[model samples]
Target chain A: MAIVAKSLKYTKHGEPQDVLELVEQKIESPQAKQVLVKILAAPINPADINTIQGKYPVKPKFPAVAGNEFVGEVICVGDEVKSVETGQHVVPLATGLGTWTTHAVYQEDQVMAVSKNVGLAEAATITVNPCTAYRMLKDFVQLKPGDTVIQNGANSAVGQAVHQLCRAWGINSIGIVRNRPEIEELKQMLQCLGATAILTEEEIRTSDIFKTGKLKRPKLAFNCVGGKSATEVSRHLDNSGVMVTYGGMSREPVTVATGPLIFKDIAFRGFWMTRWSKENYDTPERKQMFKDLCDLMEQGKFVAPVHEMVPLDKFKDAAAAALSFKGFTGKKFILDMSK
Target chain B: MAIVAKSLKYTKHGEPQDVLELVEQKIESPQAKQVLVKILAAPINPADINTIQGKYPVKPKFPAVAGNEFVGEVICVGDEVKSVETGQHVVPLATGLGTWTTHAVYQEDQVMAVSKNVGLAEAATITVNPCTAYRMLKDFVQLKPGDTVIQNGANSAVGQAVHQLCRAWGINSIGIVRNRPEIEELKQMLQCLGATAILTEEEIRTSDIFKTGKLKRPKLAFNCVGGKSATEVSRHLDNSGVMVTYGGMSREPVTVATGPLIFKDIAFRGFWMTRWSKENYDTPERKQMFKDLCDLMEQGKFVAPVHEMVPLDKFKDAAAAALSFKGFTGKKFILDMSK
Candidate 1:
């Protein structure tokens, strides 16, 4: 039987509130090696917004469906599919799955059958932000017990995830954020997530972090907001430490003084989850990383917070709410397709 | 009986040609656990110039002798000394034993005996430059047969050492130098040292190396000249590769664009021989490194090209010869301390 479904599509690239449209389309039967999935819940992530606006490198083919991560239930299997059984919940491995639809079809290998104990909303937010945070910490620098890492944009989803993961690994973290009027409240929130210390960008700039002295310096620095924030983080690292940059939210270029590279021997590196996942698809290390993350989630060491659930017809409203500063205070907006 | 020795001493820090004085003094008896050595040969390296200017870190307490590396003969040993025999040729194991005088005293354990097979000139230059080249290649990056490494200052002592060692390991090297009137002669000289490709800084900037769709890029870049040369080398690296910076000849500073660090995930690092040797002293690894370097030298894989040999009294002529800008040439000015 044909499955008639509706999907949120973008005809042109722009702000999420302006370009997204909900339209009915015919979902064909699964081809060989494909599995048809009913997308049960999907979260609105910052990367998803960037993907829709065509700002990110991993852009979907135009007139594209624009969602990277979601939780779904397998409704039907193709002729050659045997890995995932019908009626099981799953999450797609990476971007380009376009999960903002009532139903979707993907190759059997591209989907992972999740444990029944994890809730749909939590699973929806797991594949991107948490994985990115975990990989960035573990891959770039070898962190020993009591070793410290510092990062800016400490109030974002990935920042909270990094804090919790570092805590689990017996490492310390210093979080940096912009100086807002609600900084005290923000500090409390980050501390609750296991941040060892929190500071404002202005404080880091005015301090003696750069003047060579015996101060406690971080061994690794995570940067999301570029411009002066990156330069400041570079200054606070010990000799031979690394700075791994993933995002540039301020849309400013990352500038570094040559003295640090020449005198102190610091390293600069980058990380992108979509690119890493795509490149390491068939490697055993990739498989082991996924298994490790799943184990962490099963042990209750990791958690994904959902801000609000919106229906498919209210997709535009959901996108706006996700992008709005007022509604998404430490919460991720999820789309529930059941309605 | 005391040894009557003539030594060069600097009463105060000043330019190499100005304040240095040659004086005759009576050498005291060797203390317990000390050995007296007669200096044979030493090269006036760039670091020596910096030392005489009092610009190097580890400055001598004033009125001090000024060379760091040399070949010498053990003439006498203190009553308590056991390991080193008198009349054997030895080299100081880098530090505290200034090598600029006719006769000096040191602890028996503070020296390494050189084989009769290796010439004194070769042993004089071995302690720093060749060891740096070896450590930088092996310690930081994993090299495989057919992998390419590019470096600036190809005519430098360290750079020439790298070219020969890379060739021995079946690794390829692309050497960069400043444009000179004797460009053809320079290219031929580097080629004889086993450089696979040679290019001037200007040719690289105006070439198609950075154009899109190029099939080959270097797996590692070694930067001795900072500023524009470093950036140009960085532009030609494959994704996730490393650029190791050890020297800054241009004095213009190493500037890297943020796009490579954020998107391509390249790494930038620095290496210092003084720090490495001091930190890893007496380890089996350090001993093995020296042995390997000696074996390479014995097999004729490494050679120090001396341009001029000067007597101790001709110190001004030696300094001028070392600092001359005669375009693409070998190391100049060796001190024949025996004279």
Candidate 2:
């Protein structure tokens, strides 16, 4: 039987509010080794917005659906499908899953069966930010228990994940954020999530820690907001340390002074979660990472804080609110497809 | 009895031609752990020039004795000295020994006694360049037998050491050099030293081998010239590869494009042997490195290419010639202090 479904589509690339169009489309029956999943929830991440605007590398083929992650229940399974049974909840293992629709048909290997205990809202945001934070900490350097890391954009989803993960591992972190009027409240929030020290960018830039005594330097630095924030983080890195730049929110290029690179033997590298996952990795290694993340989530050490939930029909208004940082205090706006 | 000695001293920092002076001064008896040695042979290296010009960190308080690596015979031992016996030949295990003098004093632990088979000139050049090359190859990365490394400044002392050591370990190297009139001769020389390929900088920059995919990209690129050459080498590195910048001869800063760093996950780091040895490591590691270097030298995989053996009186002329790139090829300019 043909499954008639409603999906959010955009015929042209532009701002999310201007281009989003909800339309009815015919969903085909599950092909061989495929499962038909009914979408439950998906978050509007910054990367998802970039993908919708055609700025990200893996943009959907035009006249396409727009979403990289979502949590759903398997309604039907192909004859060849055996691992994931019908009525099981699953999430895509990667980006470009086009999870904004009412239903998606993907190969069995593309989806991971999530635990029943994990809420759909939390599961929806799991594949990107948390995975990125986990991989960056684990892959870049061999860190011991007491080693420290410094990161900018500490109030963002990935930064909070890093803060919690590092805390669980007995590692320390210095979190950097822009100075806002609610700086005290932001600091308390990050501290509750296990940040060791939280500082404004201006405080770090003008700190006397570098001038007077033996400075405490981080072994690794995580940079998301590029531009001068990257430079400021680099100053607190120890000799032979590495700084990994993963995002350019300020849209300004990351720059490094030649003296530190030459004299102190600091390394500069970058990380992109989608690109890293797409490259071949050992199967056992990936499985272990997922298990660890799940364990952390079950223990309440890794929690996804949702600001608000909006029905599918309100996506345009929700997306606009997500993009605008004027009044939001936490991770913003999840789309509830069940409505 | 009054112990008196004649030593070469520089009262002020300047060009090697103007400041070096021979002065007679009374030598004090060795302290409890110090030993005096009669100088044998010391080589003038570019670093020695920098030291004499007060550019190096460990500068002597002037009327400063200025020489670095050298061979000597133990003339007197302090009461507690146990490492060396009178009439034994030894070389300093570090810089700042001031090997240009007729006699010098050092702590007993500061010298390494040499085997009878190693020549004084070979021992004189052993401590710095060869050790730098050896440590860089072994300590920084895990290189298997079939791995390949590309290096610029192929005719340099450190470069020559790297070529020979890599050959001994069954690793391949592509050597790059500036264009010279005797380019063929230089190529033949490096080939005899076991370089798999040698290319002029211009050839490497514009070669069809890189563009047409005829040659494999190197996993490691060793850069000495830090301008466009380093960036060009970075372009030819494999994904997740490293480019180590150890020198900047062109005086132009190393510039890296953001795309490769962001997309490919390439790493850029620097190596300064002196700073690394002095600040980061301890005495036992230094001894182990020296022992390994001596073993390589004994196996004939490491050779100190001496350009000329000039007497101490001709130091000015030799220094002038050593500073210029016009003539005299390969490693050291030996100063025979005994003359």
lDDT of 1 by residue, B185-287 (tens): 8889888988887899988777664354332577788887788788888888888888888877766666656667767877778877877888887888888
What fraction of the true Cα-Cα contacts (under 8 Å, chains A to B) does candidate 2 also have?
A: 0.52
State the lDDT at A37 in candidate 1. 94
Candidate 1 structure, TM-score to reference: 0.87
What tens digits encode model 1's per-residue C-alpha lDDT throughout A239-295? 878888877777675665555665576887788887788888768877776677677
Error of 1 at A198 (Å): 1.7
Among these predicted structures, which one has the highest TM-score?
1
* Chain B only, TM-score of each candidate: 0.93, 0.91
- How does each model score on TM-score? 0.87, 0.82
DockQ of each: 0.35, 0.37
RMSD of 1: 4.0
